[model samples]
Target: MPDPQSLDECVSIQQWLQREHLPLASPRPPAAVHVSLYCVGKSARIPEGVIAAARQAGTAIEACQFELVFDHIITFLLPQDNAIVLAGNGGRELWQLHVQIAIEMHRLGADANLNPNFQPHTTLLYDKDVVPRIALRRPVVLAAREFVLLHNRRGQADYEELGRWPLHARG
Candidate 1:
């Protein structure tokens, strides 16, 4: 996880993972790297449709400046799609924020892979085996000041940053 404007953001995450002699992951170059408020899953062929949904979702999520704490390391049970991730510690507000985004997306007809048990996490690496979380680092806290809509084509490295809407709740 990283703060878009923080110089220490990427460096901090790298160092934390490096301490364990672990190799860092090379996820596709993000058009806009962010803590995902919602994942719309596989990219659809109809870009226009996706953009329209995002625009609608933006209206609903105009104010959601939530914080995320990447404190623990974990993995899914699968070996092939194994992943090492930094997860939040039961952040209710964050979940609500994610759910709101999802609800809005669904309202605009986006219901691809909506995992009911959404364990919010940022993947550190993907290995065949369950990379031991024996070396859990201190919490890395990040502000979800903004949420972005990114587009990648068939797992390509390049992504199109469709839009970015900041989170500044009303007083």
Candidate 2:
């Protein structure tokens, strides 16, 4: 997830979408902005074991803080609505972090359903209208110093952070 300031900048982009009269799929606060790393499945009630495994995965990964550069804006057509997002190259460091997390989750007997081909992005908003891909004049860069495990309450637009782990500087 992005730091607070970067999250605010993401929110500003969403605000721009609103000003342009685009019908927002939902109202999301700055805190909701995040690039998803793994999905731990969706159930009415999440088991304690699953949460434990996620935390364990967070602790197991040894990586340094990295930068995420979102250089373009694009729209993805979904079954429900079109999602406007900031797409970026998370680079090798990010990919390794993701892979390490997946490895740890699997080793801990958790079903993360890892995607082999992961394209990192942060969704700004969803709308019926499609926005053509546009390269930004200035790419939005986010310092990824930490990762958090969040329990998202579907339809409520609420995320409960369960655990947070900081990425230390590599020796």
For candidate 2, the C-alpha RMSD (Å) to the true structure equals: 1.8
Residue range 17-134, candidate 2, lDDT tens digits: 6677475556466778898777776796789998899888888888898899998888878888777888989898888888888889899998856788787888888778888887
Q: Model 1: per-residue lDDT, tens digit, 13-106?
A: 5455545545554432223234545676654574677678877787777455666766666765663556556666538776776777777888
* TM-score of each prediction: 0.74, 0.90
- The ten-residue window of minimal lDDT in model 2 covers 20-29
By lDDT, the best candidate is: 2
Instruction: State the TM-score for model 2.
Output: 0.90
Give lDDT: candidate 2, residue 20: 70
